[model samples]
Target: MNAILTVLEIVAPVFLVGGVGFAWVKAGFEYRIQFVTRLAMTLAVPCLIFTALMKTEADLATLGTLAVAGSLGYFVIGLAAWVILRLAGLDMRTYLAPFIFGNTGNLGIPLCFFAFGQVGLEAAVVMLAVSAIWSFTIGIWMVAGKGSGGKILKEPMIAATLLGALFLWQGWETPRFLTNTLDLIGQMAIPLMLITLGVAVARLTPGRITTALWLSVVKLAICTAVGWAVGTAFGLTGAIFGVLVLELATPVAVTAYLLAEKYEADSNAVAGYVMVSTLTCVIGLPLILGFLL
Candidate 1:
């Protein structure tokens, strides 16, 4: 009961926010949805990353584990997805983005907090940092056509992660004011992401639902099974293990769609994949808890 309520508590608001956005779009207020999403992607998301890094005190060894595990997890899933889609004769450009991008950023982090508290959040940050690096670099290169130059340069998120790692390693002091400000901004990330997700759902055309649902099921089933087996085999069955599994189990990431758009792939299909993946995970999350928790 407690677990159910906790999941509902986190997930219900997300559905409601999405429902509201859906209604708004149905009423022809589409522009408002775009505005909100832009705010979340440009401001709230970055703030969330910055604040997480600033406040987290992750150890170098642990961060290394997370980086290696996360990279491995992503690679395995991406390869499997590619093979499956290819076997099905699906358009690589249409389905690849959604398959390549997992929902490690928004839902994964919050679910980690719900499952394992502070330790889970730390693990989540480590995974997020590593995943972000890959998503911008190699992940892009995988989906982008040849000669796209999809290399990740030094960016704010990377800088923040490095500085945060330095602080943790060296015991450096962070200014109180900056810390407080980041905290405030970080707080906005969760709610805003939920709302943005809602807006994205609202804007989705009805034509793509079937494709999205198929992709969602693939994401949930394969990723969860593989994550569970790997995590258990490695004796990682506690908070960190649970968090990693949950992260892997999350739906197609929104960044996948954005990256598709940037790389001139089939962005619409990526969007559909994200939508279906997210909805299915609402059910998939509970199933994961049943197995792991």
Candidate 2:
């Protein structure tokens, strides 16, 4: 009973913020998604990642362990997803990336923070950085048939992740005023992302519900298993282990749908996956969190 409340406390705000966005969109209000996304990705999210990395008290060793574990976990999931999609006669280009990558940024980060506090947030950030790098590089190539190495390097999130890691390694801190400013900007990231997620979903017109439902279930099971195995292999315990599992088990990212749309890889199908997978998470995440807690 207590655990249920705890899980609710953690997850309620996440979905509620998203609900607001969904409602806002449904009410026929204007939401300029492109501008908001650009602002968040180019400025707010980078600030969030940079400050979180810079201020995190987690040791370099734990961070590094999670990084390696997350990388391996994603690689394994990608391979499994590719094989599964091929055997099922699904289009790899359209389905594989979404199957492999989860929403570790908007949903994962905040869930970690709420569920396990600061240490969890720190651990979650490492996984998010790892996931973002791969999504920008390999995930892009899967859908577009071409990866932009230059674009990945130019991404603000990527730069922030690298710079933040350097600062952490060097045991350095920014000036107080600067840190405060960055922190303020960074604070906007989570809420903005949650709301944006709702807005995105509300706008999507997903098809193929039956197939998407089964695929989403398969993705959740495979990702949870891989995250647990990799974290155990790496000797991750406590909050770090839990965070890794939870992050990995998050639903298909809305970004995947956007990428499919941009690259002309059956956007409606991708949207179906996103919708179904995310709905699955709404039920699945709390159960997982209950066990973890």
RMSD of each: 2.9, 0.9
Span of ten consecutive residues with least summed lDDT in model 2: 148-157
Candidate 1 regions off by >4 Å? 17-43, 146-151, 206-208
Error of 1 at 109 (Å): 2.3
Report the lDDT tens digits of candidate 1 across residue range 129-196: 77777767666666785433234444555565676677767777568897787778767766666656
Per-model CA lDDT versus the true structure: 0.69, 0.91
Candidate No. with top TM-score: 2
Clashing pairs in 1: 18-198
Model 1, residue 49: displacement in angstroms? 3.3
**Residue 270 miss distance in model 1 (angstroms):** 2.8
User: TM-score of every model?
Assistant: 0.85, 0.98
